[model samples]
Target: MFHQITVAFMLLIVRALAHDSPGGQVVLTSDETTTQESTLHVVQEELKEAEIIPTVIDDFLPKFILNVEWSSSNYASLGNLLKVKRLQSEPRITLREASDSSASLCASNMTYIVTMTDPDAPSRDNPKWSEMCHFIVTGLTLSSTSEEASSKVHFTDLQAIIPYKPPGPPPKTGKHRYVLLAFAPANGTTDPLHVSKPEDRQHWGTGKEGHGVRDWAKANGLKPVAANFFYAKNKKQ
Candidate 1:
């Protein structure tokens, strides 16, 4: 009877977690996949020990629907995962020319607007420089000249909204959230969005009033499609 109950409980748990997709119909993240696999493995072990009829273990496997990764000259940060978790130590991004290298995005005919920011400078409470723009690109497509290969890795012809500038978290300030956001024209048109990069907004993006990410996206009918971010702490050097 105990064995039967134990087996029933295990089956219930496995069934509970057996959804078509993780995180409620959107997609399964890397960490989410790891957690699911770990749980499933445990359930399988429990079933084996319980002497219960073993079911197909692959029945609970999560399918990968989408994957996107962003990398720069300084640090390689995988999509959805925070930066501080990946890097050994905070890099002095200001001194180095950290341009973007490659991204494993969905192969599609789509334009993208990439924006990076530091939302922690001058401390989190009294953030004087929130969202310090690091890099911004626009008009990226599959056949774009920016990509080295006609490899269909999801980006091609592109424009730079804000040229690449490495992370510069000020000294004495707390860690900064370096966020890279990609937006697609909400209108879904292929027309070139000839937007001139704003000036004096390099640090914290306070240079131009009302011309920020939200404003520009509204004006150009842009919708955020993808994003990645990491944290960089204050480096005295």
Candidate 2:
């Protein structure tokens, strides 16, 4: 039932992460305190009705490890970095500081292809299951030490088939979930377009294999090596 609680919060965090600037993780603030509180109240009521004991957001999902660091924000762990008032600017990543989390260092040769998706479209309650992918970086390499600055052994910027595009959810409609997943492509860049830089990332079509995380992982014969997410709220709402 703990997993169910996590799922419920994930449903709440439907607006989780979109994009973080290359500079680092950034935070977005919102003033919808009443709405936010009301949403939490609803979640609590649902939990009580189900006889479920809800825990803090930290227990909702597994945190991520990048170069021996755990993924986090000023507020809490992964999936806990809530609220992006505006869907544009990249959020600053807080990987370099994971002193409190149980983080594991990675092997030098390990690499992953990261992708983030927006599940509900036009708006959260609307149709268009084909989610809008917000960020896709291929060939991200992990190094033993933070000093290693080579792009090849770093976050795999050059292998970006699609550049980072901040998610801009349609006004109103409701909140949406943005999940980030990291995978090890078994085919080793099967698509011809999986180059250093694709012509575009903003206008790419939504489908299963091309940019979908689970679809891509299924097609590539691997699961997500790492995953992280956060939610955001629209200003108009």
Q: Once model 1 is optimally superposed onto the true structure by TM-score, how far is the C-alpha of residue 178 displaced, in angstroms? A: 0.7
**Model 2 C-alpha lDDT versus the unseen true structure:** 0.41
Off by over 4 Å in 2: 1-77, 81-107, 143-156, 186-211
**Alpha carbon deviation, residue 148, candidate 1 (Å):** 12
Over all chains combined, what TM-score does candidate 2 have? 0.50
> Which digits, one per residue and each the tens of the lDDT, describe model 2 over residues 107-156?
34445566666655455455354356566666565432253333223233
The best candidate by lDDT is 1
lDDT of 1 at 180: 47
Collision pairs in model 1: 83-230, 118-132, 141-156, 144-156, 144-157, 186-221
RMSD of each: 14.6, 11.2
* Per-residue alpha-carbon lDDT of candidate 1 for residues 125-219, written as tens digits (9 for 90 to 100): 55555435566666554333233333233223345566656555667766555554456566666666665465545343446322245544555
